[model samples]
Target: MRILLVGAGLSGAVIARALAEAGHRATVIDARAHIAGNCHTERDAETGVLVHVYGPHIFHTDDEGVWAYVNRHARFRPYRNRVKSTAQGAVYSLPINLHTINQFFGRTMRPDEARRFIEAQADTSIADPRTFEEQALRFVGPDLYRAFFKGYTEKQWGCSPADLPASILKRLPVRFNYDDNYFFHRFQGMPEDGYTPVVASILDHPGIDVHLDTPFVSDMAARHDHVFWSGPLDGYFGYDLGRLGYRSLTFERFRATGDWQGCAVMNYGDPDVPFTRITEHKHFAPWETHEGSVLYREYSKACGADDTPYYPIRLVREKALLSQYVARAAGTGNVTFVGRLGTYRYLDMDVTIREALNAADAFLHAVQANARPPVFSADPA
Candidate 1:
């Protein structure tokens, strides 16, 4: 069977490799000149420092299978994502933890005391929150919400917290103690070399043929028996159901002497601040030594036709449009939609790879059983 995989990101690369290993012909194509899409990393010509072209992606996950799969390609260095926030003329830790709570409110209460204190501070009146602001208030009350989430989320989404859904804050971690590890994933680290090399190695197989600077058109699928599309779902249908909403980013790069903000991610959690966070690229690769550092001020805005969509806005209109695309993709036989763009959900690198692996497993199972695989790997429609 000949399979045409679109967009040579993690999802496409993984699925393509799986199909090829199954004794099937797989052709992977990416519009960009590189294999890794937004996660593309390359050495800076002047500084010689490896830079993440889109944003810093920290490899962190608790799934043993996912961790083992990536480890086969490259060794991972021990790394933790400890983020800091600059808000209201001061810098503090993130995720509404005990340290963040004490620092922001000028209180040194113990964990139990702090929990009780926050419970009292919480707004019990709003039992069920419909918006982001109300959700924050119910969880941590007004003061902390205003200090941490309210402004930053507004800046990131380009909308007031009241206008956004409370589901946005679902399952966000909050610590009782001073443990400031950003993610609680069991396996958390950065690739030894970099993401680009690791991704390149994943697509390095004899049976798999990769074409960079190549875009997959609908006509390309005619020659192939199956299609695995990682591009935008609406793009597959040519936006016939109207374009899905997404938030995009613009990175302003600059060189600076000494440390910038003393951390990798320094978020500006104030509505007045234009950018949501500034990331110090040099700090990302902690093993490397550099005199001069590179930083990126990440500004988020509504996505345009030409712009790359960083985060999907899963609002009512967008969800309805996604349903239409799902229907179109389902009706169109032999084509499967996978990954963040196809599903219209903002997925981290780990989640994307995880889904890809699942898709491969499902495809193999279907091939053996002589059944049609579902259009999506994670969830259908």
Candidate 2:
């Protein structure tokens, strides 16, 4: 089979490599002159810092298989994400650790005492929290919510926390202990050579043909035996049902002589601040040292037609639109929707790779059975 894989990101590269290994000729293409999509990383020529061009993507996953698969392509240096946030002219540790709670209240309380204090501060009246604001208030109390989450959530999603889903707040945890590690995953690290090389290595199979700076047209699907599209789902159908909502990011990049924030990520929790976070590129790869430093102040807004979409704002309206697209996709023949954009969901790098592997396996099985490949191996809806 001649497989046409659209968008040479992690999803496309993984699928292309799988199909190629299974004796299928795969042609991978991307509109951008890059391969890693949002995870694209490169070296700063002037500063010698490995810069995450899209944003900071620390590769952390509990899946051992996915971790081993990534390590096969490039060296992964141990890097733990320790995030700090500034709110109301004060700096505090993120995820509301014991130190953060003590520093905010000006008391060195033990873990149990801090837990009791937070419980006392929490609004226990709200039994079943529905919105993000309610969840924050119930879990961490009003003071912590306002200082840390309210402003940040508003800036990140361009909406009030009351309007957002409770599930968003569930991703964050309030620790009674002093552990400042952002993620509790088993394996956490960044690629030694950066993400671009890892993705490039994935697509370097013998049966795979990569065409950078190539835009995938709808007509191109008809020319191939099968198609694996990792582009936007609404884009595939020409947005017949209205455009799905997404939050896109804009970076204000600058260079400094010495260390700027002394951390990989420093989030601004005050809504008064225009940007969400400032990520210093040099801190992401602590293994290498350089005289100068580079960083990006990231701002999030509603995605425009020309802008690259980052987070899927899966609100009520967007979910309805996604369901319509999923139905249309199911009826569409010879094409399988894959990846974050194609599935119209926010997916981490590890989940994206796992799904790509599963999708490839499903395709190969279908080929052996002499059956038609399904529109989606995993349901987007």
The best candidate by TM-score is 2
Q: Write the per-residue lDDT of candidate 2 for residues 1-381, one digit (tens) a residue.
A: 889999999999999999999899999989998889989998899988999999999889999999999999999999989999999999999878999999999999999999999999999998999999999999899999999999999999999999999999998999999999999999999999899999999998899999999998878888899999999999988888899999999999999998988998999999889999999999998999888999999999999999999999998999988888888887888999999999987788999999999999999999999998878757776
**TM-scores of all candidate predictions against the true structure:** 0.97, 0.99
lDDT per residue (tens digit) for residues 296-344 in model 1: 9999999999999888888777777777777777798888889999888
- For all candidates in order, the CA lDDT equals 0.87, 0.93
Off by over 4 Å in 1: none
Worst 10 contiguous positions by lDDT, candidate 2: 372-381
Would you list the clashing residue pairs of candidate 2?
A: none
Error of 2 at 335 (Å): 0.6
Pairs in steric clash, model 1: none
